[model samples]
Target: MKGPLFYSKILLFGEYGIIKDSKGLSIPYSFYNGALKNDGNASEAALNSNQSLKRFASYLKDIDQDLVRFDIDKLTDDVNAGMYFDSSIPQGYGVGSSGALVAAIYDQYAFDKITVLENLTREKLLKLKQIFSAMESFFHGKSSGLDPLNSYLSIPILINSKDNIEATGIPAQQSDGKGAVFLIDSGIIGETAPMVSLFMENMKQEGFRNMLKNQFIKHTDACVDDFLKGDIKSLFKNTKQLSKIVLNHFKPMIPQQFHELWKKGIDTNAYYLKLCGSGGGGYILGFTEDFEKAKKALSAHKLEVVYNF
Candidate 1:
């Protein structure tokens, strides 16, 4: 038996900025997806996933029942019966693999679940974020719950700040357009906790805080607005700045081998590279007005185009 499918997500505009209340935008990436499945002859991967689910089920049991509760009995029964998350979404790649899993479990088994059909008011959305935050925290030590929310809703989400978020519509993708947003696989996993800790540690420095406020967040917010408004020129300009700031200030989060590649994009107008998620070594997000030019410039690497405009 296979449950509903939940897609992966990409934080187009915001990465580390949202923690400080920067405007953020996230879109659902239909390229990779996950689902809950119970297979008769569980493969090794399925067995491994089932074991993880057993532990996750135990964690859910102790979660705040006031916010949300699950059919722990049935969930456990399924787990014991070899239920597993059959997913193509890669973990630790910053594409919301765990978020998809959380969304699928919530969709399949949660009691008094919030249906996507209901009028999603600010209060309701906020409540969903809070519940998702709590539920997803079992995977990440801390979570904003945005990933699961985006995957569950299967739409673009605009993050105004820490307290305000809403479902938003982005400009239509031009199938034949030259400009594109793509992913460069680092081909290595990235850990969220360490990268986040490094950011927090950097927060203690006065100069770092100043730069984050004056440059990093400013560019990120502008990129969000530009993308939403469909101002391609302005979006590219701001994204260039954002990419540079990430390379200069958030160096540790970026993988070592890609450092020069990231810089090359900024130096030339061919493309702009930014952190996909925590960015130790997952998928590096790339934006370019001419996909052909960007691909030629970095022909050694593999590129997966997610959006075109």
Candidate 2:
């Protein structure tokens, strides 16, 4: 048995800033995705996945029914039959591996689920976000539900603030353009909870809060606006600023090895790197005005281009 696939997601802008009511833009990364499957094989991976699903099912059962309800019986029966998630999305890479699983489960078993084909109003979007938040909390200690929502919708989402979000479109990708957005593999895993905790702790300092509000969020908001408007010059300018600010303030969140490379980007102007998601390690997002030059500068690393403009 196999269920529908749910794709991974990338928060293109507003990583930590979104937590403080800053604008965010998330897009579906269709290159990696997952689905629920049952082959009746008790292989170690399948067994482990099945057991994990059992725990997740139990967690779902305990959620307040009035808040969100699932077809618990069906879920239980499937798990008993050796169901497991078959996925390609990398875990702890900040591309929403668990989120795709959560979205697939909700799509398959949630009662009165929001169908993707339906006309999604603001009210429906909010309701889905709330339900996904509660459901995904099982993975991350806290969640905004944006990951699951993006996977479920399979579309770009624009977050105006914490309370306002909507499906949105991005400027068309220029296949032959020199400027590009890419993901650089850090070749390490990052845990969301710890990184988030660090951010929260940093928030306690008045100076950190000020930088976040005045510089980080400001640059992030501008990047989002410029990207949406197809103002490449302004977008790159703000992206460079955002990248520098993240380097200075979010140092701990960054993996130690990339410190020099991150700084080199700003000093050399080949590429500006920023945290992809809760970055202790994993993929670092890169923006460049010239992909070829950036590629040459970072020859030792692997780069996956996600967008060109």
What C-alpha lDDT, on a 0 to 100 scale, does residue 220 get in candidate 1?
Answer: 95
Query: For candidate 1, what is the TM-score?
Result: 0.99
Per-residue lDDT over 1-309 for candidate 1, one digit per residue giving the tens place of the 0 to 100 score: 889999999999889999899999999999999999986756888888899999999999999999998999999999999999999999999999999999999998899999899999888888888988998898889999999999999989999998899999999999999999999999899999899999999999999999999999999999999999999999999999999999999999999999999999998889999999989988999999999999999899999999999
List, in order, the clash count of every candidate structure.
Answer: 0, 0
Model 2: how far is 272 from its true place, Å?
Answer: 0.3
The predictions' CA RMSDs to the true structure, in order, are 0.8, 0.8
What is the model-wide C-alpha lDDT for candidate 1? 0.93
Estimate every model's Cα lDDT from 0 to 1: 0.93, 0.94
Clashing pairs in 1: none
lDDT of 2 by residue, 187-236 (tens): 99999999999999999999999999999999999999999999999998
**How much is the lDDT of residue 26 in candidate 1?**
96
